[model samples]
Target: MFRTQQSRSGNDLRFSLLILPGLRRAGMVVRLLMCSVLLLALTALSGKFGEAQAAGSTAGKHRAASSGAKGRHRSVRKKAALPAKARTPARGRRHGRAAAVVAGATAATAAAAVAASPAAPAKAITTNTKPELLPRCGFTEASRRHIFSRGVYVLDEETNTPLFERNADTVAPIASVTKLMTAIVWLDQKSLPMANRLEVTEDDLDNLKFTHSRLNVGASLSRADMLHIALMSSENRAAAAMSRDYPGGRPAFIAAMNARAQALGMPHTHFENATGLSPENVSTPRELAELVKAANRYQLIRNDSLDKQKIINIGRGQLQYINSNRLIRYGQVNATVQKTGFINESGHNMVLRLLVHDRRPVIVTMLGSGTADGSRLDGVRIAKWLNCSLN
Candidate 1:
């Protein structure tokens, strides 16, 4: 019985030793599998975190570029909000099986390192767009009719009745159109001989606006020639020279201009300078229409104003001065009296005394036209309207 018990104890000891090593091997394999699974999970999580961080970084960059200061603060805050572990490299935990686990961890660490790497930055996009256009000068009313000029007046000369009016009472700068009044004042003083030669002086140069003139200082022209160019070509220097050559000079000539305006019942007319270079030379369309009527009565004024071109002596050579009133020069209307004027302050302006059907007379005045063509078109439109009204 004792011998049998000893043999059984030896067998049991040998079996226990064999089974213990096998159980250790199984536990090692299970530990290696657990480590591999944990590493893969960590690697995947790191990759996901990296993707999120890349997305945040790209968005933050866009925001920073879009907004100046506030977006920069938001980007800094987003980077700072990430957990310390997520921001740094993910490392695998050590186990009892050193060599096997180290190999797996090394592979996982390499993969996680690759996964956590920052992605390429996103590109910014831009768009090309066209520039805005300038605002047009005219406006359309409820009646659907557009008037380019700011002020307009049409009058029947025989009946002295307003045929059409648009802001006619608004007083504005008349510009070189003031030359018409200057011509009227000049013709009234018949004693000043038209044959008398007047020399342009430094006083005739436009000091107020510093405007250039072809008729230079020391240039001479007869009173009739001076008057001709002044009305036909809006010759500022010629008008100024005529004023300087008047019986009492420019001051007296200017006074006579105002006096004549008053005599013609133009209560709103005022002449500051003969050249109309001064913005103070102002008159309303209604008053200017009346002035155009008075100017038409003077045969000399009518003839000079209607002339398309006049040859004048300028000391060097004879230069032809063309009429500034395109409506009359182009024969667009039977304009008995016509004048056109412009200055920065006055814009484009025109006055016309038109002979209509049955020897009847019509006076049209346009002020503050946005362009030269605007004034001319205004005249054409009024003439057409008059023709339609008569029919």
Candidate 2:
């Protein structure tokens, strides 16, 4: 048995040796196939890991998403919780926005109230009162400048405190500012409420040529309207009616005007007509300043002096009339109150009360100048220039 087993083993060895070369070739081919399969599997695994790392980094690489499967699970839950408001349709979005705005406003208001508790300072109140007087003007013998001024005077409503008295006290015809007195007298004693109707006839429009009036016949006006036109537009008809409708007639109104002048200590002043159309009507610039002060006391005239425009209802419709004083046009003080008058007798006359810088109030009256408008424009220009220079 031993000998037979040995013989078979030997034959098997001899058989194995004969096929060894072929078997080794087959083994080399198998080893190559196994290595190719391992390389392909490794490449696939590397691609998967690279893609997972890229996706994780894109999600902000936040600590909440970077801790393995637990972080990814939390990220998914958070994404499901809320989204942008725009994800919903725009229908009724305005209402939702309004509600959110109201909520935000409520929160802001609560915060503001808490911040502004009880210790805040109050705001200031202001009024259009007189500004401080500027430096005293020296147009005296010592100073040769300001030749056109002739002299300087601190002309006031109370008295002409003669700072430089040339012919300043000389009484002369003061023009349209005379209407201011006319309005004042009418307001004092008339048909109670002077805002009455006026029967404007052709007779009333007779000699108001150099002057202008848009008022027509059968035009109804409140006494307020008449006064407004009289002081603001310098309307002749309004002045005539105010004068004629006095206790008596034109005479009474004129008497009242003179009486008021006397009451105001205007000894050199006299008014013949409600309007200063007649060269016969005269007053000193000094006295007229005082007259203005008195007339302005009634508030109605002062209110009229500042009016920019007025629309009076005629029988047909409304007629627009603008104030003649250029200063208070549209409430800008080119001229706070100004009266312009020119009659053939009185060359051209003006009384202008203007606002100046530093809240100063200035009064200028011109009796006669060469131009038709009676240029106290020089005086106004001087005042404004001085204000600009000083301010």
Candidate 3:
């Protein structure tokens, strides 16, 4: 019975060992499954936590983007609400404001940006000033009414003020009216003897314009007689001889003529020759008005200029030369000093210092009259106008 028991025990022990190994293996497999279960639970928990974190981050980003958009919208609305004039900033200021607005600024920040911007320049305001009233005589309109000369200057001798004028400052050839200047210059010389006889030679002839002359070469006349005939008849040869007999000759005489013009304040007057034959002898009516006043100072000029007719001695016989100015003969006007000039280029020109209605001293200087008798007609019209207006 003991041997059987021992053998059974050994078999039992073998079985037990085998069963133990199996048990151990079963336990290990169960433990491994539990560990796997634990690891799966932890992983599920970690995944849930990560998903929550991602959702929170997305919500924050949305909030930030919405805040930025709302800020920009508010800024635009506020800017739009401003007045039309205020919203449009000046050139330089607008550029700065635009740069600040582009930089993702808030409404309050944009307002500050605009406030910090530079001020624009102010606009200028103009004020109206009253104009001056020109001097007017009662006869202003009447003076212009009857005058037909292309250039006319009427002056009040008492005041030496201009009464009426048309192209008065225009420079034009004065033609034989230049004799007035010649007569003035000749008489100005204190040393030259007026009674001294000056001979008319070939040099006295008008070679430039080839104008007709009644005074022949080799004829002799006193300086006073030459001047008288020159002024009265507009004798070309007599004027030439007067210039030739000047102390320093024609060139000196011409220089004196210009000097005398300047002294008389004739800014636009210029003389190229002694006689008026050259078209270069030019003056403005404004200047000639002053010249007429100056010429009227001399008694001889005033007398000779208005003389109806003058008797001049030729080579052997006396020749009577009528005044070129018809007004001196025909007109009822009492002219103190009168000079007439004519050329194809200058038209008809005249300068008259006359007493209107035997009371007022008026000077009428007309240039570029239409016809040969046009200037005389103008003079008569002016006199009639003055008489009617002054009375």
Candidate 4:
């Protein structure tokens, strides 16, 4: 019985030893798994933090660029608002170039960031309040070299060759130069006798520009006298009266003016009214040169336009109308055909057909002079140039 009890105790002791080693090994495996899970959690949190930091940095850069562009735009506006006397041109130009460069860089970076995001609204950047100023007239730098007038053209009447040209193709208001055409159209109708007396009425008053005329309403004059005054003095009333006296009235006269212009190869020329009070009466310098050539064919236009003064009897009084062209009255040029015109839109305009050397006929037309004297000076300069060329 004692031997049997000792064997059972030994068997229990061996089983206990084996179970303890297996329990220790299982604990070590469980601890290793827990450590690995903790490490994975820490690594995941660090990666998420890095991503958030990068997104925040990108957003901050975008905001900074947007604000910078806005600041530049405000600065440019302030500079433009400065008084002309206060601003130095050299400094202004430098700042302008710098602003342009900064603006371009900001726009490119912002565009790149926007393309990456695609959900953000794009901000507009403005650089200046007023755009850059550009030249209004003259085709080439050489053509605009010395000419102050907006448009200038010199043509040799004999050969119809353009001697000099500046903004010659630009169509603009011609003012009372339309009268030359009016005289031509009026005389074209041989049936309409010049001896027939035409009375100035309220309809003849310039309603478009409210211009003054010495030929008062209700004054009576022959058709020939109306043409004479219109061509010589740029009398708006006389031209309007003649247009009203046409077979089909003012509308027909206007149509005839346009038709005559078309026939004369003046495709860009248009006439809204005979008196040239309307700004719609437009012609190019080249086209007007052709017009001068055509009007020179009329002997009466040549006779009346060159006259310095005309004393006409009107209602028991004689009103002597002086020629409007200072170039003619002052003997500045021996103009065969000369007409001067002015309006707010057309400026001081003049067309002249004059003998330059001995008998070399040349036509000079200038438009957009600031003053009457300016127009006269332009004509004088052109005449001198022509004389030099002829010699």
Candidate 5:
């Protein structure tokens, strides 16, 4: 069908030429035929040239490879080629150099990244054995919710080593735990007549507001009565009275407390107030245990601390104050002395010295208890756990 159409076109052109106004009809026909032949030759030549160009470009980009060809020392053919529409740029002749620069840049980046990272040990050190976790201490299976603190601790009356421990060095307020220390220092410093006519004054009542004590104003009380109320009931006024009665008043009392803590080797402990009102008044469970041990050395602190019940006749007459620390009657161990402390900032804090199964005195301190019962339970739990596990 295509050949038929071409034949028809040629016939029309030939017929048109035959009728054209010209020097002669035959001559005009011959001239038209010659012109058509020349056009055909030119079209064929253009097609061949285009095909050769396309083939060359598809072979590869031209590179100036050194070689001997023909008569010239270096034969330069139109070796580098491009598509008919796209011409090659001279700058791209240095492709190898450009690639080298990029390779170097990548290597440098890798090296910099490696250098910036933490270095592994030079030796190919390796271990395949299972690691040893510390032996479980203090109530190992006890639920964490039942614990009074965020840390782990172990109490053994026989072995001074912690049966268990976790972050035991952190310092925190001792709360009424401060009173035991106060009583210890008092017993040591004041040799004034045991009945030195100690009186609870206005300042003592005023200080009770911050201490959570129930001591009323205008209550006349003796030194011994104040000590019992303070140690057993955690009365702030009683503690304050003791602090103010020191040789140099409260500041002197605080200095003595700090001095005594340092002397006791409680390196991280500090006392800003005698009644433990300030959250800044802090110590470690480890240090508190030390303080409890030291406190037990004194007769008054040990006796009052061990008592589970007490009845004092203050100015109010026939006043009764129950022992705040309940571990004394827990029956886990015979507690020689114990004190309990609680505040929003300190939670429930308690310390106790007890006669253990082997007759060794074990002292324990626990902090951040969940409830009022927490401190007492912590002491009994530790004691019980120690007997079962450590022994």
Candidate 6:
């Protein structure tokens, strides 16, 4: 029995040893599996972290690029807001182009305006240095209608004022009105007697003008009668005879006339004869007014000139002479002194010391009338105008 027991124990030991080796192998395999599982989980976690870091880096780069772009846009805006002097070269180029366009448009508009508009007379040259002689007045136009004489002068005798005048300085023939000066020169001779009879001869005949004479060649008359006929009738024979009978004869009488005219400021007067038959017998209206004023101082001249009619008895027959002035003959005007004259070259002429309202003496002289009664009509018009305008 003992022997069988020992053999069984040895077999049990062998079986135990084999079982230990197999159990050791199974424990090693389980520990290796657990380590591999833990390594796999750790690797998956590291991959997820790496992916998160890459995504964050890419997002940061995009944000930085967007911010840089905005800053550049702001810088460009700031430069654009500067003034032209402070502007960059690029901005100056833009402004220069715009100014060029405006200048071209302005030039074109000015050229069009100049092309749309019309063109301007020439003047005469004169060398006349004489000062104007016509009186300056506001009523020149109105007074022109009231006067018909080519030469006219109206003066206020009392005040020695000029009322109206036209061409008064024009030199013209005096015609029979020359007798006024002749009468003045004759009367100035105090030695000449009024009752001295003077014989009419062939020299008294009007040889130049060839005018008719009522007094015959052999007729005789006193100085008073001769003077009366000469002044009243404007008889050429009577005037010639009186000049011949003067103290120094015809030459002396003519000299006295010119001297008297010069003394009276008659600058434009020249007398060739006493009868005013010659065309050379010239005087201006301004000068003739002075002659009238001087002659009016004589009572004989004033009476004879204003006389309507007078009867003179010579040896042959009874003769009647009438004043030539129609104004005095018809009593149409209260003229204190007057004379009438007519010649082809001188035209109709008249001078009068007209008494307005029987008080004021207005001297009016007219020359170069176109019509026979033109001077008379002018006198009437002057009277009417003075009455209407002044009164």
**In candidate 5, what are the lDDT values of residues 1-391, reduced to their tens digit?**
9999999999989877875555476797899999999999999999999999987776533322222223132223343342222223456758756766777798799889875554332121111211111113223233334666643344554556555454568877778789878888888885645565576777775443354456666676778778877887788888888898888898998999999999999998888888887788888887887787787778887777666677766656767777766665444567777788877888887776766666766666777877877666666666775454433
| Runs in model 4 lying further than 4 Å from the true structure | 1-146
Q: Score each candidate by Cα lDDT.
A: 0.80, 0.64, 0.81, 0.82, 0.69, 0.80
- Predicted structure 4: lDDT: 0.82
TM-score of each: 0.62, 0.56, 0.63, 0.63, 0.60, 0.63
Q: Which 10-residue window of candidate 1 scores lowest in summed lDDT? A: 129-138
Model 6 residue pairs with clashes: none
Judged by whole-model lDDT over C-alpha atoms, candidate 2 comes out at 0.64
> Which parts of model 1 are misplaced by more than 4 Å?
1-144
Instruction: Report the C-alpha lDDT of model 2 over 286-387, residue by residue, as the tens digit.
Output: 776676666656677777877778887665677777777553564434434566666666666666665556355556666666663325544554454445
Stronger candidate by TM-score (1 vs 5): 1
Model 6 TM-score, 2 decimals: 0.63
Please provide, for model 1 over 275-326, each residue's C-alpha lDDT reduced to its tens digit, 9 standing for 90 to 100: 8889999999989987897888899889988999888876567879888878
- Predict model 1's lDDT versus the native: 0.80
What's the count of clashing pairs in each model shown?
0, 7, 0, 0, 5, 0
Model 3 lDDT tens row, 141-238: 33445556899887878766565678989999999889999999999988888887888899988888788887888887888889888888888899
Task: Answer with 2 or 5, whichever has the higher lDDT.
Answer: 5
Once model 1 is optimally superposed onto the true structure by TM-score, how far is the C-alpha of residue 57 displaced, in angstroms?
49
Clashing pairs in 5: 62-80, 305-337, 305-338, 306-336, 306-337
Positional deviation of residue 275's Cα in model 5 after best superposition, in angstroms: 0.6
CA shift of 207, model 5, Å: 4.9
Give one digit per residue, the lDDT tens place, for model 4 in 8-36: 99998988899878999999999999999
Q: What is the Cα root-mean-square deviation between model 3 and the actual structure?
A: 25.3
Error of 4 at 104 (Å): 54
Candidate that would win on lDDT: 4
